[model samples]
Target: MEASTSERPAAAEGGVAPMVRFDRVTKRYGALTVLDDLQLDIAAGEKVAIIGPSGSGKTTVLRMLMTLERIDGGVIWVDGEPMTHMPGPGAAGSGSLVPASQRHLRQVRGKVGMVFQHFNLFPHMSALKNCMEAPVTVLGLSRKEARERGAELLSMVGLGDKLDHFPGQLSGGQQQRVAIARALAMRPKVMLFDEVTSALDPELVGEVLTVIRKLGAEHDLTMIMVTHQMGFAKEFADRVCFFYQGRIAETGAPAELFGNPENERTRQFLSAVLEAG
Candidate 1:
């Protein structure tokens, strides 16, 4: 059920390999199958927007990539390496893969960074300290180096003056910006935004999206976003994927898909969303 425009070539025949690949990945919770054999590829530096109704498994995609949820079936590859499994007794490219060790998972997962809907900043730490913790501990960066990197990212997100403010002291949108800066401090190759603006006040959404727009323009990072912001997606994404029943029912350039959707479900969904809005 993978879908894409003719302009976007299939992953196997592409000029460069995909930065991330969900190879027949599946996820289940008890009798509920959340993601069913989902196969997708994202090239390096691509901006992909995933849109679907609730319970269609959009957020699960990011969670799986972040290793917050394990798959029931298939391999998830990141940066040409398997994140869910490791090569078994052979060379890295062509060989059997067994379930990955914790060390292997940690190594591969380091390439991805995710920002969830809610601003999960620590209330006790200043915005600067929140951005600096991971680099200092996980990446083994010295306090001096982490501080510099953290400050740079915070400033990039337009929070230079609020670095010393704790989460409770800042607005919701401001806190989310810090979360983005914190994620960027790790220098991830892939960035995932799961309904990042969903929890923001209506007027505040623009500020966060503005920062994201700047990020896409300035960074080489691949960005994957699952969002309901149709206007933003239409303006910002390189590709739009419409998920239905846990699979992509339609995908194409923003103008092509939004203006002339081929799938009935896609058209109906868009109509409902537009009407509701």
Candidate 2:
């Protein structure tokens, strides 16, 4: 499909704007394209789950939003501002998708945080220090204030006692929880979970999912999770998107998509996943 940029959708009847939008976005590695002219909009405070077989571009979607990967074409808008590009000088909303400057990117990225499958914690730092580092260094919080905030977040994820523990001393699940707390310390408006439990032992998966469930239920943050855990997705997500070969093949409420998938590919995929489980 050819890439095309388009205007943002009008606000909902309630006048609430969408928090994120992908307008005819595309990604490619040489001749092999991953995302093809995709379009998706996520409202503020919405919980969305992206699920599909490996290499279906589910993870790529999150990576793109976090600015880890650059788009080959089209634009991405965050909080109604261009993310993949900046407005031209004196053009005032009339510019093309030129590359965003580092300053612009950093400003836009402050509102987003991501948790990876592998616990990417610093081995040398204690849980408290790990959580406190970014907010102190990047967000400019004082050492005392960052420490207090980090302690509270660690406690929220059931790690109040593990504050002084190093990543080497913690189990995979505990380490992942620390990672989540670290992300939360940034006070991001949007959170991305990319197969967060995929690297954990089968028994430890539930612990991490439980914390995520709590976040979804209690916090007003917009969440987009790319997970293979269909049951959890159905339970926690307000909307579920199924991707196939980089395009959104099907999307709807969890109950409808998981219970009675309208697309044949979705049906086949669900059947395969269910049987594997």
Candidate 3:
């Protein structure tokens, strides 16, 4: 089913605009449509959890927002500016969306950071070095400044003692925590977590979740996470979006959606996921 603007929260209420907005966004892979005219809004400092069955386009949302994937249609607005398109003439962020230049993409992408399912760390770099690399190279921070920032973040994620440890030397949970710290080192306004714990051993999941929970509690970031950890989502997210067939089947506050889902698909999904656990 096609999602209408009516289904989404107002893009801007009062004078405040959303930190992120997907305006009639669409994505396709060959003949298969992955996201069908999706409309969604996320306010600053809000934590949103996207949950759905495999192939329902949950991960696609994060990947696209992080610009790892491109949309076939529509604009993606981030920090009140177009991330997927170039802002038109005159005032910044004005007029119609147009295809963005690579320079435009790189400029806008700096405001968002993503942690993937697999810890895509540099095999040869130490945890702290991995965190320091981008800040020094991309953001042009002094190596000393980047190193200090990286060490602080690693400490925040409970890896202060493992600064010198390579990804191979770290446990799966430890590696994922380092990944989270590395993302934070970028100082992004928006953070994307794509099933960050999915690659961890079952016993390792809690430690990664603990670091994430700590970051959420203390940070003012706009976080969008694709996760299967229902209990954590129910507890952590300000809003829960249940996706089905490439559109949002249902969305609401955690208590409302998880406790009393109105959509049949959402209800069935939650029931099955809960039962499976």
Leading candidate by TM-score: 2
Candidate 2 vs. true structure, TM-score = 0.96
- Backbone-clash count (model 1): 0
Give per-residue CA lDDT, model 1, range 123-216, as digits (tens): 8899999999999999999999999999999999999999899999999899889999999999999999999999999999999999999999
Model 1: lDDT to the true structure: 0.89
TM-score of 1: 0.94
Q: Report the C-alpha displacement of residue 198, candidate 1, in angstroms.
A: 0.2
The regions of model 1 sitting more than 4 angstroms off are 1-14, 90-94
Better of 1 and 2 by lDDT: 2
**Per-residue lDDT tens digits of candidate 3, residues 1-277?**
1212122224565656688999889999999999998989899999999999999999999999999998888778888777877755553433544577789999999999999899899999999999999999999999999999999999999999999999999999999999999999999999999999999889999999998899889989999999999999999999999999999999999999999999999989999999999
The models' CA-based lDDT, in order, is 0.89, 0.91, 0.89
Error of 2 at 233 (Å): 0.4
lDDT of 2 by residue, 78-173 (tens): 887877777655656554345788899999998899999998999999999999999999999999999999999999999999999999999999
In model 3, how large is the Cα lDDT of residue 201?
Answer: 89
How well does candidate 2 score on lDDT at residue 168?
Answer: 97
